[model samples]
Target: MLRWRPWLPPLLPLLSLLTLLVLSDLTSSSPTAAPTETGAGWSPPAPVNHLTCYFCENVENNYICNRFAIDHPCPAGTTFCRTLHIMDTRGGSVVVNKHCATEDQCRDDRVGCLQQDHQKTCVSCCHSSYCNEPVPTNYSNAVRQPKPTAPTRAVKSAGAAAAPRLLLLLAAAASRLLLLLAAAASRQLLSGSRQL
Candidate 1:
């Protein structure tokens, strides 16, 4: 018991080495470490929650449909793809619009008969991604019909959230490594003092 100080000097280095080894194992074995190595230069995209719809609006005789192949990301809370076809006064003016629609807007197909013109709007809702690629033909007998089952296009996966977590893990590992090294150095100094 009187010479406990000398024994402590040797044990300190052993304890520090063991801690370093354990920390190395933890850092390497962490799940986030693998992705961090591979995705070093890459950042994940944001999470996609909105539907991309083909949007076009044209007046009759313009036949300007598809003029712009714009992929519109619908506003949040709007989950369905919609196609609206309108006929004005015996096709005098026809307008078609494709866009993201809400559930209420896609409740049913509506036809309005005005004094000088008849307007027919076909509302269709689709749950799948980019399901409104094709324009709707029948607007008069509208119902909330699901698009036919077909091969769905692959959506881009977003990885924006993962990068930050990986960075935090790396920081933690580096800090732990630094602490271990400091402990080892202190142990060395104590042992040297005992020799003096």
Candidate 2:
């Protein structure tokens, strides 16, 4: 009587593939299903937590400004944009800073403004994503504009979306590697059996 044990080696790979597929399906569905069901009538809103601004800081007569300004995501509890202009007559230096701010920091339209001799400082705050894109070239003539207050609470961060994507990629690579190993092992077993 021929034993059935010889067939088990070839079946192991098929079984492993099915198991991985089932596990992937289960993991992918758990996190996304509830959100889709609850938001049936409402489409998800765009991510507005990220802020972009033009940032340049000059001190001691050093000047720096570029077109390739980067977008910086605010930390938790920071929802406003701020632009600061400072000028000092000591050496005729001007500094500009654009970055994320908090509700308290931006409470007043102007955070700081002082003029002494040729020294001056001007700060303006606004509550909108990318609102600080424009940098005031003329610190003495820049005007502060009123802006709406943003919500004080911090929203969900964008990094939450990256984890699942990474997991999926790793799963795909593992599945492919398992398949190749199984193929090689099966081929070796067939050759050995034929030689018996």
Candidate 3:
């Protein structure tokens, strides 16, 4: 002989709903995952700090620049220190310009030393503090352009990306199943109550 519990029928639907909610929460992606993790395509924001550089302009010679260069802090968004050396072959004269430079400016002018008949120009860029203090007089020893920044977002692999979608789909399906079960359980409880 078996005894039917009157309260269990209604409670079954509530329990199933609770279980589905918990499962959905557990399967969801973490909110802070992108910021905390350094994946293949994810990079942290660049740190903002005072960047010091050797600053001068049209100093005419490397030795003069070395003696007269001022240590100055670069403005916001200007990361590299630059030195532009210009040599006039026919005139036997050298002109130097040193200043704080942005990455774009460095990239645009980093063609090394190019000679056009009687004149040669070279641009050097560096990131360390006072890196432009020792200006290069010629093309052979000039610094190359600074490297570009890392990408802002992470690239997802096929399987790794598919996993979250699969979990979401499973959760959605489970929710529907739980709702159907609740509907059936409610109907059974209503019939039982009506009979009583």
Candidate 4:
């Protein structure tokens, strides 16, 4: 009665049709409609990790932090034309980022490159060389020997270049002395001859 009361006000025509159909056979009736389900969704893929040089763990974001926008979709003609986005972080915000067409350009730790008109790029974060850090195996006077210490910042000596200037001045002074002695000897000899 509650359901009929709300609908009865506006559903007069449908109600009249059911009343007319009451005279029809009760056994034979139209089937009810079925409902449909849309199962349309996708699961997100896991993020991958990139290994790089020890010194270059951090990557800078683009001019804008963390956000990178690209207009070109690749492979209009070939499979090799696929382009991938690279996420890089800088500061608290992500600033540095680049895109690359090949795995060689984007993922290769040894080699970094940029493609597609500088719109995309890859960079190196190469691991530290074996000798950069000390290893225990080389201890206790081992035959293999320990790695040498990395050179530190030192002021270069300018002593070498300054030495030559002193030598040049000494040579000039020696030549001047020889000339003065020759002049004195010549003058003395001439004066003695004239007096005689």
Candidate 5:
């Protein structure tokens, strides 16, 4: 025996719409998805591919690092080549370190040198190969260069960055709408079944 219920017709449209929404969400690719970490404290950059840098650390002489720098491939998540030069103002000792670094490591460093209590630290970051070979110079009060601009790479515009956030917000709103519609439809079905 086959029985056709009148209440089921209204739910068909709602079920179809819900299925479509779910399918669309699953199919559409999201640009703002969280990136996989390569290793400890390493999130790969999107702008550049593999980078080769000079790796060395010397506490005595700045020229020794540049003279005997190892051409090393950067790690998966490291994007910039960093050169750190620390000068002890009291003892007149210079420490030079050139290695592959992440963006966060170079975030606070600027073009000119920064002086602390008794030591002046200068950190310079570059994107190209062997860019960190040149050791950072000592602090000079006369040289006041302007803030260095971002590296020559594809920088996302404000609108482009906001687009992903907007998509997520819309998706959330759609989900809430679907839940409310389902609840309303269920209540309607319950009342209709009770009457009959």
Candidate 6:
């Protein structure tokens, strides 16, 4: 037989495993359960989708590190601010030449503080709003209104102006006819009296 002593080291791991199995069966009728619920330490999988941040491209290779003053500042985890901008009002829409650290880039839009119409008309228009709000944002919210439309063309009525003249002319004609009738009646009455 080969030397059993020489094989002892190589077979030691196998022997220990077998010994454990035999002892486990003898000690308990059923295997003991984990101290905690099964799979207690496991966690849910990661999210499937994630939004990426935009970078400012207003200027050449300008990296967007901060948020613009408009809209919501760089979204919490936004990586960059793009050179996106819109006119808050009509006098002149803001143009974002420089990239903002935040998503919206504007100190205060030139036309911002005031309400305006598509024609670039301000709330200060005559017969409308008297350019009241010192600060527009809060004021606009308080009085939300629709944009004003263009004025319609009006035509003048010719008869309306000639009314007084027409009345004067009719009065003159009536008076002349009445005077002639009165004179004729008076003549007839005088003649009759003389004959009597």
Best by TM-score: 3
Provide TM-scores for the models.
0.40, 0.41, 0.45, 0.24, 0.42, 0.24
By TM-score, the better pick of 5 and 6 is 5
The Cα local distance difference test for each model comes to 0.57, 0.61, 0.71, 0.33, 0.67, 0.35
Candidate 3 lowest-lDDT run of ten:
147-156
RMSD of each: 14.5, 10.9, 14.9, 47.8, 14.8, 48.9
Candidate 6, residue 81: Cα displacement in angstroms equals: 43
**Model 3 lDDT tens row, 40-144:** 554555556567877778888877887888866788899888888888885344788888888777785464777777888777888778777765546666766
Best by lDDT: 3
For model 5, residues 73-165, the per-residue Cα lDDT tens digits are: 887788788887787876354788888878777675454588889887777777777767666665542122233366523254566667766
In model 5, what lDDT does residue 57 have?
Answer: 79
Worst 10 residues of 5 by lDDT: 139-148
**How well is each residue in 37-72 modelled by candidate 1, as lDDT tens digits?**
566654444446657776766634224555565765
- Candidate 5: list runs displaced more than 4 Å: 1-49, 90-93, 109-112, 138-196
How well does candidate 6 match the true structure in TM-score terms? Answer: 0.24
Better of 1 and 5 by lDDT: 5
lDDT for residue 122 in candidate 1, whole number 0-100: 44
Q: Candidate 2 residues 1-196, lDDT tens each?
A: 2233566676776868775985578476533322456665544544456554455555222235435445557666776677776666653447767777777777654565667677676677666676665544354434454554344232233355666676777777767766766676767777778999
Residue pairs in candidate 3 whose N, alpha carbon or C atoms collide under 3 angstroms: 41-153
**Residue-wise lDDT of candidate 4 within 1-196, one digit each (tens)?**
0111333334445544553444232323443433434435443343333211111112343333223333333322211111112432321322243232333332334233334442433333212121111111111211222223344212223565565566556555655654555455556656767999
Residue 101 in candidate 3 has what lDDT?
A: 84
The Cα RMSD in angstroms, rounded to one decimal, for candidate 3 relative to the true structure is 14.9
- Residue 172's lDDT in candidate 4: 55
